[model samples]
Target: MDFETEQATRYQRIIDLLSPPDGTPTSTAKLEGELEGESDDIHEAITDLIAFGELELVNSSQHGRVRLHQPTPSTKAQATLTDPTEYVWHAYITERDGLGRTRARRLFKDREVAEEHLKQIVNVETLTPVPGIKKVWCASLGSKGYTPEYAVLRREPVFQQADDPYPESR
Candidate 1:
């Protein structure tokens, strides 16, 4: 009855407050007004946001607004490429240096782009994982330091002995 109505209102309020939830700022007062309930509803909605990992609470002096902060990979520093698929090629841009004196952003797209980028990261650098194929690094956008090492580069696909490279569609 009344409780159901209150719950529905609160739920709708949260949905409307965090629409898209892409680093958008929302205030407690706005949520409370939208819920059309007492002050406690705001707390509940905030709790929900935290549990969902969509909200980044900061002091009023810092943000001055309640907003969401999605988890993004670190692309500021350089790390070992024991794996690369764990990171996106072009998504995260990191600072690299040849002699640790120069610094620049490392943004590569595919194997070709990675080769070019690797040329810039000098001083004890090599290919992603496949040894003897130095000067190439690729990372997966899946997780941290978990690149797809299984993927072989420049390897021919195994066919059933009756396939053409570019066959016409039937």
Candidate 2:
């Protein structure tokens, strides 16, 4: 078989091997043994599958498992916020019914006000900090019919240290 065809076949095999019903965690060493190919090719195929979001890798020092990628609703929401430039910092108070459905959403200019309002409505534990809050680049507040739900702006760099030098600035 051609290189592309062979690679495709390998990708399918890996997907099948990692799929549910068995769902057993397969290590890289095991995959190398089972696939009967160059270790590089197998690793590349695994990377490609992960890039395509068809597979997820769970890893530790000793071994790793490849599994079918399962993304939750919250993950989907967070994905939209990956681009920091598109959003602004805003605080929101989301009131949800007993069934966990969102009943009301209110945006606040100040974080403390939003927190206080949220405290009065529901348990603090239920207050989820949404990361992305879109900015209105073009028009004033009056132009928009409804207020956007509040979410905390993720301003910290991924590589920043836990003990931020300027914590007060945040």
Candidate 3:
């Protein structure tokens, strides 16, 4: 089937799984197990449903239940758009010692600033720029000891003064 059809089918499957005609509450774990290997699709469907106000989470001590959420026309319209606003590009620097142990790490909003700072702090010939995305939830909740993954955006040359290009000459 087509992409939209497939997505709609997945959404319907999730809805049917959660809100069966019997009205029995399905636990999150059970729903996950039923969905099996299609975790990503299931996650996206649930997120979309929640965003559209078609689903709500009922949290319990053991497991959560998915309940139907009655939505207004506006919310349904907003949910139809698939673009997510919870993620943004971020720049990060990881400094390692001679033994390759992590020495320091810094995060920056601007990519150029991060590259410049990396060039100054460490005496490497080039700066290895790492690109990543910061999530709104993690930033707002303040994770402890959690390091984000990054991709290499670009390499920057180490700065050198005009007269003192060779430090040994000075």
Give the top-scoring candidate (TM-score): 2
| Per-model TM values vs. the true structure | 0.29, 0.36, 0.34
lDDT per prediction? 0.37, 0.41, 0.40
Off by over 4 Å in 1: 1-12, 38-40, 61-64, 72-170
What would the per-residue lDDT of candidate 2 be over residues 49-114, giving only the tens digit for each residue? 543334556664565566655321122233434452332222333211111112324555454565
- How many steric clashes between backbone atoms does each model show? 11, 0, 0
lDDT of 3 by residue, 56-87 (tens): 65554575566654221123233432342222
Candidate 1 global CA lDDT score: 0.37
Deviation from native of the Cα of residue 156 in model 3, angstroms: 55
- lDDT per residue for candidate 1 within 51-98, as digits (tens), equals 222344544442234554433322321132234344334212221111
TM-score of the candidate numbered 1?
A: 0.29
Model 2 global lDDT (CA atoms, 0 to 1): 0.41
Sorting all predicted structures by TM-score, with the top scorer first, yields: 2, 3, 1
Model number with the top lDDT = 2
